[model samples]
Target: MTKSTKPAAKKPAASKAAPKSSKAVAAPAPAEANKVAKTQIIDMVASATTLSKKQAAEAVSSMLDLIATALKDGKSVGLPGLGTLSVAATAERQGVRPGTSDKITIPAGKKVRFKVASTLKGTL
Candidate 1:
């Protein structure tokens, strides 16, 4: 003779917390097909410069990592003919929930901003 067992029901969270999946972020798609992608840029660099494709890719990756590290350290990065990347401080503010229309206080945070170079801005 065999005994049967049933699964126990799960309990809901006590606090009304945001979902783990809500933090998902997706990069915006390019508006034009003519826009160049990372791979294309790497290939272009390989062809234009003396570096091989692999070397060019590594250099690009390292450069990006350096820039990100700088921003994380609260330092501004200046890219000649491109733009400047800097972090801005934001104060706490009041916001309303979408569905319930309940007022909520948004916490202070930092955001990245870009300033276009005058030469680059003139071209576009």
Candidate 2:
């Protein structure tokens, strides 16, 4: 018969989490609108080259696949108008974990590195 007070305790916890969830939901909309997605890029390519959307998409996909294959083979790729991309070896290092704030050792790894061409940097 005393269920009223029992429910009140749970309401505060849910209310505390609601704003955080709402903020997370609200933040992504503007970011998504701002970025040009693959679809938009394909559309642009189609119009610029006078190619059908399907053809443009295939061309873009093939180019990306070629770049990925080159990187996997540890070859440095230099796109004349874009940049140079290469796989760089990383040394083992010590770092702090963000959530737990604990000291941790990060093992050695290979990471992709990009150096923007001077011409591209100037245009940007």
Q: Quantify all predictions' global Cα lDDT against the true fold.
A: 0.84, 0.95
- Encode model 1's per-residue lDDT on 1-124: one tens digit a residue: 1232222221234222345334433223434466887888899999999999999999988998999999999999999999999999999999999999999999999999999999999999
Whole-model lDDT, model 1: 0.84
The CA lDDT at 55 in model 2 is: 100
Model 2 misplaced regions, further than 4 Å: 1-27, 99-101
Local error of candidate 2 at residue 4 (angstroms): 25
Local accuracy of candidate 2 as per-residue lDDT tens digits, 1-43? 4799879988998999999999999999997988998889999
> Poorest 10 consecutive residues of model 2 by lDDT?
1-10
Off by over 4 Å in 1: 1-34
